[model samples]
Target: MDKIDKQILAILQEDASTPVAEIAEKVNLSSTPCWRRIQKLEEDGVILRRVALLDADKLNVGVTVFVSIKTNQHNANWYSQFSNTVKLIPEVVEFYRMSGNIDYLLRVVVPNIAAYDAVYQKLTQSNALFDVNASFAMEQIKHTTALPLDYAGLN
Candidate 1:
């Protein structure tokens, strides 16, 4: 992607609802070419999908918890089963496999401590986890979905 494409992606990351004409004007491009670039980006899988950002507080799910999981089983079948189980739980928004003391990490959102406990119980019941640790987030200082574009060498 060129500089203009990077600019387009930056703008879209901030607000996907921005009109194509407005983005085109800001990026110093006519409407047609800007629109074409956006289409190409989507086709190339650069622009995955647009989504509405919801307020967690307003939704009554402000509490955020980070869960660390360690398991003795590292087989592919066990991993697939664990992943499928986690996917079924709506409270688990993000899950990652890391290299360290913890085998997996999960970001869970819930209404309160009770709800989080319920999720924890559900998870433990679904799969065998050797160790599980949870930490509550006291404050969310900064949160964003925007990816850094400088790494793309478009700056």
Candidate 2:
């Protein structure tokens, strides 16, 4: 990708709904070229699916919980089963395999403590975990889906 592609990405990351003409104007290109660039970005997988950001408080799922999981079973079959079980829980919005003492981490969102407990119960019932720890966030200081484009080394 070139500088124009990076500029397009930076703009789209802020608001995918921005008009092609506006993007072209900002990037000093014609509308057709800007539109084609966006299409190319999509076809090349540089630009994934666009989505609307939702307000958790308004949705009644304000509470955020980070769960750290350490498992005794590290085999492929065990991981497959664990991943499948985790995927079934709607509250688990993010899941990651960590490099530190924690084997896996999950970010869960719920309405309240009781709702979180229900999700916790579901997670444990499906698979056996060696150790599970959960930490609740009192406040969300910053949350964003936008990625930094400077890291791409575009001029």
Candidate 3:
């Protein structure tokens, strides 16, 4: 991607709902070229998907907890089962297969601790986890859904 593409991405990350004409103005490009660039970006999979980010608190999913899970059985079958089971749980917002101290990390969102516990009970009983540890977020200092832009070193 060129400088204009990078600029377009940055603007879109901040607000995907931004008009093509506005983006063109911001990047000092004409509407047609700007629209073409955006189309190219999307076609090339640079711009993945556009989504509406909803407020968790307003949606009654105020509590967020990080759950770290470890399983003694590290086989492919076990991993597949675990992943499938976790995906079925709506409360689990994000799940990552990790390295080091944790095998898998899950970001869970619910109404409160009691609701979390209910989800927890369901998870453990699902035959996917051998051990699970959860940590609740006391305060979110910096939470961003945006990825960092490092274009300086790029050739």
Best by TM-score: 1
lDDT of 3: 0.90
Quantify all predictions' global Cα lDDT against the true fold: 0.96, 0.93, 0.90
- Backbone clash count, each prediction separately: 0, 0, 0
lDDT comparison, 1 vs 2, better candidate: 1
How big is the positional error of residue 149 in model 1, measured in Å on the Cα after superposition?
0.1
Please provide, for model 2 over 28-119, each residue's C-alpha lDDT reduced to its tens digit, 9 standing for 90 to 100: 99999999999999998888899888898999999999999998888999899999989989999999999989999999999999999999
Regions of model 2 farther than 4 Å from truth: 153-155
- Which candidate has the highest lDDT of all? 1
TM-score of each: 0.97, 0.95, 0.94
Candidate 3 runs further than 4 Å off: 151-155
lDDT of 1 at 74: 91
Which pairs of residues collide in model 3? none
lDDT of 3 at 43: 100
